[model samples]
Target: MSSILRELGALVIDADLLAREVVAPGTPGLAALVEEFGPGVLTPDGELDRPAVASRVFGDEAARRTLEGIVHPRVYEEIQRLEAEAPPGAVVVHDIPLLAESGRADSFDAVVVVDAPLATQVERMVRDRGWSEDDARSRAAAQASREDRLAVATHVVENTGTREDLRRRVEEVWADLHAR
Candidate 1:
C-alpha cells in the first residue's frame, strides 16, 4: 500500500522505519530503553537487539506498554514533523500496523486497510519471511483481528490474490483517494 501510494506521489510516513530510527544506537530513545530494560536489549556492539527486546516484551502486557511509552511519542513527533513538511494537497499516508489496536483509526482523514486472510498471512510469514508456522500464527494472534481492522477501514485492499491483482486494487484505491 505504501509503495503504491509513493508511486502515486504521496508522502509516506512508515511507522516501522520511524520506530527503528527513534531507537537507533546512541539516541535518547535507546538510552531510555536501556535504562528500563537493561543491557540485554543491546548487541555486543551496543546496537539495539530488536529480537532480544521482543523476547522481553512479547507476552507481557506491562512490558509492552512500557516499550510503547518509550517509543511511540518519539515516532509521533517525527511523523508530525514529516506531515508538517509535506507539500499542500499532497496525500500523506501513514503506514501504521496498529491503527485500530492503538485506538487511532479516527485520527486520519481516511483509513485504507491492505488485508489478507489469516491463513494467507501465516503462509506468507512462513514461505516468504522464513518464520515457523507457529511463530507466524502467534504473531498474527497478537494483532487486531481481521474483523477489527475491517470495522475501521474506509477502504479495504484485499491482498488474497496475485501481485497484479494487488496493483490493480491499489490503483483503484488511488483513484478513489483522488476523487475525494
Candidate 2:
C-alpha cells in the first residue's frame, strides 16, 4: 500500500521507519529505552539491539507500554514535521501497523487493511522471515484480531493471493483513492 501510494505521488510516512529513526543511536529515545530496559537493550557497539528489546517487551504489556511511551512521541513529532512540510493538497499516507491497536482508526480519512488468514500469516512469518512458529503465532496474536481490524477498515486488500494479484489490487486502490 505504501509503495503504491508513493508511486501515485503521495507523501508516505512509514511508522516502522520512523520508529527506528526516533530510537537511533545517540537519540533521546534510545537513551530513554536504555534507562527503562537497562543497558542490555544496546549492543556492545552502542547501537540499539532491536531483537533484545523485542524479546524483553514482546509478551509484557507494561514493558511494551514503557517502550511506547519513550518512542511514540518522537515518532509523532517526526510525522507532524513531515506532514507540515508536504505540499498543499498532497495525499499523505502513514503506514502505521498498529492503527487499530492504538485506537487510531479515526485519525485518517480512510483505513486500508492488507489482510490474510491467521494460518497464512504464521506460515509466512515462519517460512519467509525465519521466525519460530510459536513466536510468529504469539506476535500475530498480540495484534488486533482480524474482525476488529475489518470493522474499522474502509478498504480491505486481501493478501491471500499471488504478487500479481496484490499488484492488481493495489492499482485498483490507487484508482479509488484518486477518484475520492
Task: Say which candidate scores most in lDDT.
Answer: 1
- What is the per-residue lDDT of model 2 for residues 83-135, given as tens digits with 9 covering 90 to 100? 99999878788899888888879988888899999999999999998999988
**lDDT at residue 95 of model 2 (Cα atoms):** 93
RMSD score of candidate 2 (Å): 1.1
Looking at model 2, residue 40 earns an lDDT score of 95
User: What's the lDDT for candidate 2?
Assistant: 0.88
Q: Across residues 53-81, which tens digit of lDDT does each residue of candidate 1 receive?
A: 87678677799889999999999999999
Model 2 worst lDDT window (10 residues): 171-180
lDDT of each: 0.90, 0.88
